[model samples]
Target: MGELGEVPNQLQSFRVQDAKCYCCNHSHIHPHSGESLPCDRQLVYETFKKWWSAGAEEGSEQHLERFNTLVRQRVAPKVARGLGIALPFHYVVYMAVFCMVPWLSDFIALWAETRDHRAAVSMWSLRHFIAWGIVGVALLFALRMCVWLWKLGSRIEKRLDSRWCAVFIVAPLSFFGVCALWLPIGISLAATPEDNPLPVFLFIAAIAITALVWRAPKWQEPLPSKQPSPHVFQRKEDNATFSI
Candidate 1:
């Protein structure tokens, strides 16, 4: 066991094991940031893109300075131009992807289980189908309401308030909270770990993303000058050339 004056390799390994790693969410066995370090400027990039797309005046020095400050603060300015076009369709695409959650969950679970054992899978087939059927019905009703809200949002933009968007978030989150009250009891009854956990995760992610969608920036109140009253424009002398 002895080499003359040799340091032990096991002691070095032990020290390495005890070291702390800052990246990749892994324990020590490597130097700091064994993976790529966090890019702190991603938020700044998003903020810059937001303001740039919001019609920031290029010729104005004040506008450029303000843009820099806003980027520093990581503020998402009003969506404009190309971003405006994309923003309107974001909810539609988000809803489409989330709507498939229930069906996808069922398909994945069934495929994995059937491949393992046919008879065991058949035992729960009808029950699983009924559960997913209920999920589909719920999704259909929710999707219908979301579509209505999207249409209404276009109309409501003229008024410039986010209350409707906030209300939309409230309904889904409240529904999820109510459903979650029963999740503990349901999970306890499942015979195996491979049962339906995706629904709960999907619900939470859906609510969180919905909240993010509405958090960009509040709609600006329309200027009073543009919306002059009907009587304001009714002039007595339409042809009068009144020089200042």
Candidate 2:
């Protein structure tokens, strides 16, 4: 939770302006957004930052107002917990530390297996040298490609709404990632074969996914720009429900 930052000690206060918070997804609908609640706005802040960094006029009153609504309705309460703070707060960092556990455990297991395999291989053998060289090159290339894809996705995601971003970009990249991760095992098995078709197929699939995400329209056909209906959010302050 260090990434969430320390909670401020200022006492919570009410605003003179009676402006109510609207649902982040629905602009016109007023919702219950009390001050010093809903402190976790990491995803909303991150999304807004991506747009702001891309030269979006986030400082403009119109954009800022919309962003404020999002922060209050969707994001701020998580960060505001235990901190005496006002509503309509701003933030950009997102929650990512939760992901560390799953990948960390898997990596430890992988490292153990790799160490075991290393003990069996003789450095003097020509076959061992060639295999290591190929695997190293492949891993390096894969790493480069994955990084590029991540950057590309970040840029492309900026153009779309969150829902569309998830549909066109996130879903495809997830599949491509799964394929890329699993295919390395197949490549290792087919190492003796002069040509490994799995790598080629994986490469082509990844490229296709990237291309599709890049070309997909950020949003559907534009409709009349009218205020949206807001949805009410009920706070779970009492930990009555336990979640893992």
Candidate 3:
């Protein structure tokens, strides 16, 4: 963890060790201070600082009202806008990865059987449980990768100031890139008529999962803008009074 002095005073109250700013995809070092703070946390810190310095005394109705106003006017809209631009890429990445998992598991299983013929025997014999365990582990790994890719997309989205333009450019390139990479595999798998139905099933499952994730209540909820504690402001007020 870095010392508090490494962070800018405006952002120090909200600093978390090793935290990265999603907007810039950098550690919580402020550009000037060389300490990083996450985007939303930075917004909250700035908003509160602005409200306090503007003489919105804590515990008063005016303080609460002003803080809320600043949040609505400055913070909520930016957060919402960024999420709106980022979420579609996240969904697409997740769906694509989910659809790839079954194929990946099958590939690994085939490789394992090739390495040791006994593993192939175990795959179909009474020891089939061992094969299933392999599939289960692969599924877990694929799911973890999906989440990582989703977060990566969000971080990339935040870094772009012109999100719409970036999306238009990146989305098509990503789509074609995935297709080109998968084409040979798809054609090879197609030669095996028995495997034809598997792709369809995987595609449908991916769509269903993506839809569920999209409709999740947590996704629809707004990012929380945390208010500064009243005691912080009270202490500042007491100090100012003493100085006067």
Pick the TM-score winner. 3
Q: Which candidate tops lDDT?
A: 3
> Roughly what TM-score does model 2 have, to 2 decimal places?
0.22
lDDT string, candidate 2, 27-87, tens digits? 3233455433332233444565566454655443333345545545444444454222211
Expressed as tens digits, the lDDT of each residue in 154-228 for candidate 3 is 545566755565556556655564444334334533453432444344434444554554454432224434454
Candidate 1 local lDDT, 40-116, one digit each (tens): 23344345546555564543333333443443233222212122232444565566557667587766677566655
Report lDDT (CA) for all predictions.
0.40, 0.38, 0.42
lDDT of 1: 0.40
Model 1 TM-score, 2 decimals: 0.23
User: Using Cα atoms with residue i matched to residue i, what is each candidate's TM-score against the true structure?
Assistant: 0.23, 0.22, 0.26
Output the better candidate (1/2) by lDDT: 1
Per lDDT, what order, best first? Answer: 3, 1, 2
Q: Any idea what lDDT model 2 has?
A: 0.38
Write out the backbone clash pairs for model 3: 28-35, 28-36, 28-37, 29-35, 29-36, 30-35
Error of 2 at 177 (Å): 8.1
